[model samples]
Target: MEYIDLYLIHWPMTVKPGKYEFPFPKDEIEPFDMKSVWEAMEECLRLGLTKAIGVSNFSSKKLHALLSTAQIPPSVNQVEVNPLWQQRKLRELCVAKGIQICAWSPLGARGALWGSDGVMECAVLMEIAEAKGKTLAQICLRWVYEQGDVVLVKSFNEKRMMENLDILGWELSDEDNHKISQIPQCKGYQGLDFVSPSGLTNPSWSFGMVRFDSIIVERERLQRTVGLIEPIVDSAVIPSGIVISSIYLKYKKMGRIPEVLLISAAPDSKPMPMIGFGTATYPFGPSEAARSAVVRAVAAGYRHFDTAAVYGSETSLGEAVADAVESGLVGSRDELFITSKLWCSDAHSDRVIPALRKTLQNLQMEYIDLYLIHWPIIRNFALDREIPPAVNQVEVNPLWQQKKLREFCVEKGIKICAYSPLGAKGTVWGNDRVMECEVLKEIAQAKGKTLAQICLRWVHEQGDCVLVKSYNDQRMKENLEIFDWELSEEDKYKINQIPQQRSVPAEDFISDVGPFKSLMELWDGEI
Candidate 1:
């Protein structure tokens, strides 16, 4: 009982109906009785024989049948999963059912048993591994590790074992993640013995068929159980994956909003955690006050930190991240997703890389998780760079949602993170039109939520990410409560009925003598 905490139903097989396999006469083959077996497992849980029970090699079709009848729902499904396999069908089913997924041989075996090493030999995985200064093994492990699933790497050699353990302390970038997805999927381990015609398998669905119900369920079971993002590793507990919005967050328990609320550059790009820490404050530089606020956010489970060099919080954010890791609030620099923007002054192609380098130096990190163009000014027309921008941070709210620009960017496979999501209430540049709207106020009262949450949730529910700033801890926590619940159809219809207008009439860009003589010309009439 003490040695093993989790006992699994390895495969969907049991003793032949009239023949007992456990006390085998070394003659009879095992027959399938998955239902009765699972019931027995539940009884074990009731008797305290095991803390949890799950299954392995059971496809999504099998899982659904089990869930419908299970008295104690299985907590996890262990399987031989890898980048080569992709496991999209199983992953989707697992995400919806709140069952955690853990991988057995995450890296495909070739020399060990299988003739071909799909994962370790793949060009994309190799390329990513080289660029990230990690082993192919590490890349494969990290890929699944990032999937918010526990990866089991089998190696007795000290160096390779060390490499497996080194999965922590660093991470794979979205670029690497995209490349891995580009590799065509082929399962490395087809070691299922029960798939043959004579072997026992589910009668309702073919052994290979993996279909499930359309109903999707999402629960952050992995974060609460494994705590994989924390520094103190649990010896007995393994990591797991939860389906949130059909995207894998790679140990995204650090993601404050659970159930996979993320924004991606591409459908395949490593999805960016939804909420971001906005540093566009009254006094831009990372003062002690600004740094303290970020630190508090870090402690409160924020991984995406948004700052612009112009905001003057880069250095303070850098310092704060270093402090956060040293203080054990965060596990590593990679755990927090740092986003920095290029100010308009450095918008020229020649100045872009140097400006980004300067920002990286200020943040005191080897690489920034995401670097963006701060503005869409005329200078952007002439800008150039080797690395493309990941996101375009702009002012957007219900009043100025910029639906057209967002669609264009989505086609280009670039994400849009809305700043000033809430009407920047305290600033001269912002107005109270959104927060003070009568419709929004009525919706807030009806939902029993704050006006700020209503506004932030609107942007989140629109399938976009939002940046919000709150120095107040209580307020910051409130802003992040978007994913737990959702807006109703009536509330959404009321919001859509809201009148739209451009908040920032860029008069500064218009001059009688300049090219943009009117605000319409300045924004091409978007204003």
Candidate 2:
């Protein structure tokens, strides 16, 4: 009892009746009953495996059945109870029966299941957190506990776990609780009756049918994020497809609204056309020349703005973005798709937030639409040529590097934008191993696509906002034409045959003075 504050049976090991299938369907087994599991929990409590024992993810009917059979009733029942799917009745029953309710996925689980709608991102919650100087998670947990239930928040990270437990001292006002309770319940998880014949027979059962209702609700919640921009009313503008129009008309349509604009440079607004001018950023130094170039691009109707802190051009870019907004070129900041990169120096887990703050300050923006790791190096390394080899060599990409950064960004709702995607200019394409590998080229030839297009397409497939840089307009247009053609399985297999090799040499910059050894180390992980 002293060893554990609480013990929870995560999920029923047995699949639903129709859902159960054993090893290639040859060794099928019947579904096991939760009554047996509850019996086991009773034994554990008697033996002192926990001070309090409970069942997680149990339905109301399941709980009642368990109660009817158990010698000792469960102290708690853990289940998903976010704003979208409040599980109010279950919570009320647990309260009435003297059973504590622990919310398992209070913030929603995977995107496919939860669809992002919840009290987690509610304006009221955010306002409360801002007033109290706490996080939304902290506020949500406090709400859960205030209702006389133990909140079962989980995180693999030690820091996050510790943060989850730090919500005890703060209390919410009665008014706050009432407002939170008033939030309309929306369903995030559907197909709860998976055992029903119709559900079992559906093909979507294999992948789980995501509740689109919740997705629409979540989109409505975040609609304010893009609310500032006015909608374009032209009958010619379609929601999705290649946008073929003068840069001015495209800007006039998209700039007035809170929507994504798919721009291309083709005369005919046909599908799969080339993009004339892709988003560009002048990294490495601050130059008025670069600002002028951006101004020119904006004047030519480019809606996407890309910048970074390490490049020192964010200040100028910010000024340009502000000017663009003020000049009516873009109706609001939300109308523009702004992307920036987090430098290698700021890739440390602890440094992520502060680094983003600095970027925001420099850019004079509230939030960035997308942020990328400039390079993929895991440890601090130098870029000086004169440094001796003994002092220069440092660890580069540790498998966990990009994964940690990506998780942090994903949780925060910041899009991950991959830059120098093929590894800096020389490193990715220059390597003999990479160049000699005929698979990518073969795929390109087979699909009548450029080798660079194959690389960009592969990166795009990974769910990142891909940034491909080119000085030549033709190359830029060719790079932008990627969305038109889909690479076949054979093409992907041919490209996969090529072995991994660093295009930019890490040894050239392994001095341990900056965030990365070289550009190669920055892109060590595949997208």
Candidate 3:
């Protein structure tokens, strides 16, 4: 007990309470509730469970989210920080928040999971190490120490251990630091399997992929753009980038339901609602049904609409917007954000603008707020003039996490508006892999939220705009209700641990008779 000075949650995602397994099986993980869990940590502080409570592998955004509700913010964040994987964002955020930065994989985890060979093999680190008359590992540890970070280094050999402890004796030159910073960042260790959804039920196969800062990066994106959020009635969610706030203002208006949170693309772009209404449905569902749902969505305070030419519901969606304007549900078409996509057949370079124009014509709108290549794979590609797509529509959920694709989109500054976030559990081609997942069900039961709500909220929590579709008016309203509440850090964690599957795979097109060959050829083996 005396030796244990600090206790930490090693990873954010919590596996089932019993025992930990490498290829963690299905129904073995529980959703993580960050605030509630932190509160428990605070209780530990009261009981002297440990002198300090800390977290490992947390990013800036995750730390910020933790800080948002923590009674006692984390004392430290121990993470991988090396010459090869510099974690600059996490470092700066920790400094600003007065939480000490602790580097765990100081030498890039050469023999461990999530470690990259790049750190040991880096030309820049080798150059510095040779010049300084130190081991490359020593130089790596020294570099982290030079950055005012506490480095946790390990060595099993006596001589190597002495050298590991000797990092403080020497310094890395300023020129060397610059070169190290410019090493052309690529992740070394990827443990995305920790949060992947598909491996749970089927234990033999696992989702082995890279997870950079989904918890941190996505949260940082939201915080930088949307700012801090509070659930109290006094607080408003990202409205006009902070115009006014007063707890007493509720008296000025009574019984007012919260509206969709509005965020700007840039400082100049008009504010657009985050939760959008999806016009896509079961292939057999009628356009009129989608049209009616759009009306209900708008009346329920959704101002963003998503559709595609492939979905064949654009005209009805447009008519619904027109009807909403005429009936005073919305002041003008400008108040709503409309997004459409180019189906595969018309996804050709020359056909791109024409397809968008066709969609615009069908919707009776002059310009679309967003347009996307409905599918990223280009069976054929060249170039033609067209507006840049503001978003890319994809099927994202706990089961189909799409970690690599999501990270790439986040890196490229493209918004990922997820459709079918619940995995379309009841659809003909769809299965219960999503809604019936025990982790999701546990989260729903714990939070007192529906399975659909937990899934929708999971998508939103990942810091992407989400589109939800429902035929019934009540369900439409229910789908639109995601904005007012939130999922906890634990909820997000459990969702992350769900095994990944390729939802809505174009198997028909991926067969030997079709384009290229194999689903692996199509997805680059991400599935």
Candidate 4:
């Protein structure tokens, strides 16, 4: 073990150099210098001594300060959380910063010296455990897991460990979640031993425990700001988009448009939405922004969603859907259509099912509405499958309309779902060619529409489904407004005359040793 997987600061306080002991001298206590300490953590990451660095017991204020000066933001924040102490405020802050919460003492450390019996003895948890036929600890742990946070439970006994791991296969009902939400909140652990007399300031808390003074209060006063301590909108209260960047944003109920049957022959096929939201973003990684954006999209009436394993958005998309359901934005998961793709690397026969299963797991869904081979260059896909492919998703925009493939797919009863419909600006495979087209610009100006709206309208008018990606609240709603308007024949003619070019060529998939050897071979001269 040359390198550790994760390294975290145990506490956000410092003491004099000596053999470690509790109840340190007040004169020896010192404020934690976050900037210098985080710099060293960054150095540790750079030197490959640790895969990730983070902090434990960091309140929202401390985490905010560290993030402000951090070259590399904390990957995780280890915090104490349970039904008794949900830490919703702290959890929201961490989510917005893209910091994962690793819940310590998730069961409230019921038997430890610093633990409380509140979580273990709560009547709400007891009732849930009895009704569900599970242990109280299991019920507590499952609730934390459902919050999209990691749970840490220590059990040396074999049977107890097995019980802890068994929380995954099933879920708590919405009623159970509601009951737990009403439980009185109070933190279990109070680090009063570390609060020095000299540094002590505010001492009282809801639980009647002495809160650490300088660690929680002073640091908060110094670090808290309108931007840092500001809370994310509670979907239950707000149930819509919130103000962002000093702009009030409200996601309009774009309403459900007609769904197109993907496979006319398959009796079990679900209809795919004609205009879907794309969750693929450049600098691909899962973040709260992705989840929050998807939630807002759902509020704005987006039913069909496009995600892939490689895009790294499946988890966030899944979480967002769960949130939407919990918030009553949608009746259930079945009401929304979700489509995921098999990555090119997993195109082999042996890998396909496993990849799809992993995709389902990431999405936390039993089945996918539509699944497509992300690209054709991976391995040769046989057409003799038990289920025929329903859709062929590719790059399509005003500049590159993919006329040849579009006609071929429509003739074969397969729908064409267009990705990069606006040239996918700011990505390695994307360029500004489509957005900067003079012809589309003139048409957009004349019609009093944004350049993006013009491109999407053209794609929708072509009888092809469009996948539009946007994180902005106003833009997300604006993308869905293309259904009402109709593009004129002259506007269509001008768009058709634009020079055609593919935005995303499979150069990365091509290699001398791999299946695809060149661009021409990959696309079979389609480009």
Candidates' RMSD to native: 20.0, 21.2, 19.6, 21.1
Q: Report the candidate with higher TM-score, 1 versus 4.
A: 1
What tens digits encode model 1's per-residue C-alpha lDDT throughout 1-527?
Answer: 45357879976655355843333332233446667888999888878888888998677667878887888889889987788666666777788888889897787766865424656776667778788888888888888988878776778799888878988888788767765654434445433223222232235433333211111111112222112233333222112232212111123342234212123333222335667888877755568888899888876767678888888989989999888766656435655667787887897889999999999999999887677776554112112223344555667787777777666555454456777887887876787888888988999999999998998888876546678899999998787677556788899888888889866665776778976788767676676
Which pairs of residues collide in model 1? Answer: 95-243, 96-217, 146-250, 147-250, 284-311, 285-312, 286-312
Residue range 82-180, candidate 2, lDDT tens digits? 654566657656877788887756666544443454456666678778888988878888877776766667688898888889888878887676556
Per-prediction TM-score: 0.53, 0.37, 0.48, 0.51
Q: Which has the better TM-score: candidate 1, or candidate 3?
A: 1
Highest TM-score: give the candidate number.
1
Decoy 3 TM-score against native: 0.48
* 79-159 per-residue lDDT for model 4 (tens digits): 898997787777878888899999999888878877867688877799999999999999999999999999998999999
Error of 4 at 4 (Å): 82
Ranking by TM-score: 1, 4, 3, 2
Model 4 poorest 10 in a row by lDDT:
221-230
Model 2, stretches more than 4 Å misplaced? 1-283, 292-305, 323-329, 341-358, 370-417, 426-437, 508-527
lDDT of 3 at 277: 76
- Runs of candidate 4 with Cα error greater than 4 angstroms are 1-256, 264-266, 377-388
Index of the highest-lDDT prediction: 4
| CA lDDT, every model vs. true structure | 0.66, 0.51, 0.64, 0.73
